[model samples]
Target: MISESTPLAAVEQAMQALLDDVVPLASESVALGEATGRVLAEAVEATMDVPPFDNSAMDGYALHHSDAGHTLPIIGRVAAGDSPLALERGTCARIFTGGALPEGADCVVMQEKACVTDGHATLPGDVPEGDNVRRRGRDVAQGSQLLGAGMRLDAAALGHLAAQGIDKVQVRCKPRVALLSTGDEIIEPGKPLASGQIYNSNRPMLVALLEGFGADVIHIQHVPDNAEDTRRCLREAALAADIVVSTGGVSVGEEDHVKAALEALGELNLWRLAIRPGKPLALGRLPGGDGQLTRFVGLPGNPVSGYVGAWLFLRPLLGAMQGCTAMAELPRLWATSTFGTSTGPRQHYMRVRLDFSREGIQAHAFTDQNSGVLSSCVGADALAVVPPHSQVAQGDLLECLWLKA
Candidate 1:
């Protein structure tokens, strides 16, 4: 339904509109073992203090600070997990690492700092109070917020939860996605190639990217370039998935049936963003059962276009849907440019490899930036954003979006 008179939408404007329409999915409680890479739905509070009690930092002698500069008789021994013991004045308890500090003991003299002879220990004269002792709640306090909502559960975060005796947590459910690849000329790999047919490369690539963004790909189908087939596929996808993403058949060509089919089934909210290699991007919604509407995204057929669009658009969309604060935006850093380029009315996202050195970070752009050159994306570290009508030169600072896994 887009025409020459249809103005191009800025990238930021389109992104904001898409995000505004998202309604996060439901949350569920999952075991800690299964929570890796999931976003927390609620904040976690510490049930008990970390290190529960004051303990020795290492193998040491637990003693009162006043006993400094004196040879104290060894009254008893204590190791980790032993019940608390009372320390008499002028007497010390031989304690090992993580051992609970005894009553009346204010400091621990490490074994290396003491000389033991004939059941007595000689301590340094200047032992300070509370030295080498890990106080209760030093790492985390009881009833304090341990992890905030919308935080992704990484290894360290999971370990922190384990420390708090949390075996399960509430996390946002993964978004269900349906991916469609259009064009009859596209053939699956390992199939005998016809004269005019090319192997389908977008499916596997997009699947990996979608999974990387924490989406559960529920449906994957190749749609032939026909209005009837496109509409049928879109309807089926909408019914089964929360989001339907398609590649190809979005441009204004006669063979492009996806746009017409989308308009027939639902509403086309946006089309034609002002960005190179992905200008013909489409955003729409499709009607679903139970009065629910499924979100839709149409990407260009070029492999590079699909790849770039996945990072620029799909990543943030999924992040917002899952309420993940960290995934809401790509991490950007300014890097010195190692190549020169000029842009037109549309902004360009060039794939580049970053060089981190003592001096600073530098971006090395691939030589071939054409949309059809999928090889340009291999091992790419970041996307260098070149603004419209701007000329960039070597040594100039350019903002780059880091391509994190």
Candidate 2:
């Protein structure tokens, strides 16, 4: 079990051990139109070469290279999608862009460089063979791997698949997730707030974050600060989802029932991490149906902690389940700090806005570093990782995690 003083690197190592055995969700075949934002389960190979035939790249005269500087009769004309025409020796053909090259032609001179009159065209003397032509298989070759497994299909990837005449592809299924928000003091928005009641902010924020990470949230429930209720909700969520994520009720306070309930129904692997604003994070596994284990991650009740935890933990978990290699980790970059600060035992994940300029990348931290200040994350670009027991000065280099959705 990770203690409250365990460093972030040690916690990451522990989490990786849990994730090593995770099996990706099943794959399904979907049309190219529905494949956007899905991860490829298998490599896709090209069935036919792109631009299957040698064709003219411009509207010009197709002629033999030896006929350069000589006037030749224009025997025939060919437009795009037309069948290849045979060109006799010393004769030229009027060819448009994408038109198949004539059998006896070796080069094409653009119309700007060719003078045509009396059914004859004069070609430039310096024209070279294969000029103004698109060779077969120049863009893509037949029987070649077009896309690899675990690659996310974006617009360009989908278009590339379509270029190979592939209308359907196999992709990993979206990971199913269950979100639970705890605390009796938490009330839904639009409801009358009592003196001690605070509106529930973690549900909507986490739901959006989960969906953005490519998770399909199948279940969402608000569990009161009761131990029995927490246990019941977790059991049902474990049976239904690949992962069960809960916010609040994991601390050591009297109202904290999630930790106890998780222990009662499953195993708590790690309890805390050495990170500011999110130290009370929990990791565990519960038994699901079919003898499979459901991953559990409990985040703090504070809105900012939940937000930060979502990026740090939940995103990578979903990426692993969906077999998306690109989303396996957040992109890291080094930037010069524009603000000065100091830290103690816990590493601080300071929310900062990044500035790109000729000088260098600069990280500008928000003024308030408090965990409850959710506004600090509104326009934040990256998380500046400030090491424990260190002091940062202006212009000092720090590693930052880019916050990409």
Candidate 3:
């Protein structure tokens, strides 16, 4: 019953219990070029130095610091693809950006800062030692660990590995999640729904949401509200995938059958959360098909409520499977609210839009903020969060979670 009211921590603890049983669904080796957004299964150690050697930072002259102020002969030229260079005293190489610096050269003087006349360049600036010099092994030394296990790949990290000459990496496989919706009053899209049935929008919305989280929804099916059939579908889905997410029937209503089904199979736990629009959601596990066990997330029926639950809870668990160490940490952004608002004992997610100008950020809350109205979510750039029982002033600092989620 969760009569005492479920705190956010309780929900988090429940989520952690389910995630403890999670392992990468499967793994496949991928070339480093295609590994962006993939989860690393093993630590990636640098096999060679990044940049491999000292390199030019700009199209300039490279020479020893002893020749910083005096004229040096333009003895050679080095572009991106030329062979290794050798340097001598009072010698400067016309080096292009990304070209390796010649041996014995320690600094690069920008061409704009030097006057070249008669094959000799006069450096005007007092360039410091190691100035503009990307030393050998300075960025990342050979045999050093570049990224650790459980690190999710991002663009910057990928560039780091590419600079180290790593062509491939071992990554945690993406998990396959199965989606199923149960209710007698639901109908598939593209067909005109009958009087008692509504077009199933939640399924499609959840499908895209799961995909955005880097999960593969292998199978999404519609199960009738009938108890036995719902049980059978859930049973099969549990065995078929690592996690199964159902969008209805968790509440204690006559049509609700998920609780009974879970009880029939294994242990079942439910929480009536302290958050508005998501109090009816539940989580549990059972012995699924193929003699395997799996985690289950039962979200509310309202489209926006289901989405909120998916983002707040399901996103973190799925992220953990993808090797992200801090998946549950939501982004915290700050803004000033345009108007004061009332909050309940339960936490709330109010749709908000931000205005950025010379006046600074002004957050405007949506007029229609019902959880059933998914329209507010369509163009929402942020969510203005109010902690439990807090009263906000018009110009008060407010936490706005960005829609990047």
Q: Provide the RMSD of all predictions against the true structure, rounded to 1 decimal.
A: 1.6, 2.4, 3.1
Ranking by TM-score: 1, 2, 3
Across residues 265-293, which tens digit of lDDT does each residue of candidate 2 receive? 99888787778879888889998989999
Model 1 TM-score, 2 decimals: 0.96
Candidates 1 and 3 compared: the better one by lDDT is 1
Candidate 1, residues 253-350, lDDT tens digits: the string is 99999988999999898899899889999998999868999999999999999999999999989988899868877999899999999999999999
Q: Which of 1 and 2 is the better model by lDDT?
A: 1
Please provide, for model 3 over 1-405, each residue's C-alpha lDDT reduced to its tens digit, 9 standing for 90 to 100. 332344443455666665766665556799998888787888888888777778888899989888888988999999987875699988898999888888888889988998999999998657887777777888888888899987878899899878877788888777779898888898888988778888888998999888777788997888887789988988888888878898888777889887678767765665556676677776778786676778888888888888778777787878877867656656878889988888777778787888888877889887888888998778777777788899989999998877674
List the candidate 3 regions with Cα displacement exceeding 4 Å: 1-28, 68-71, 355-362
Q: Estimate candidate 3's alpha-carbon lDDT, on a 0 to 1 scale.
A: 0.80
What is the total number of backbone clashes in candidate 2? 0
On TM-score, the candidate that comes out on top is: 1
What's the residue-level lDDT of 134 in candidate 3?
79
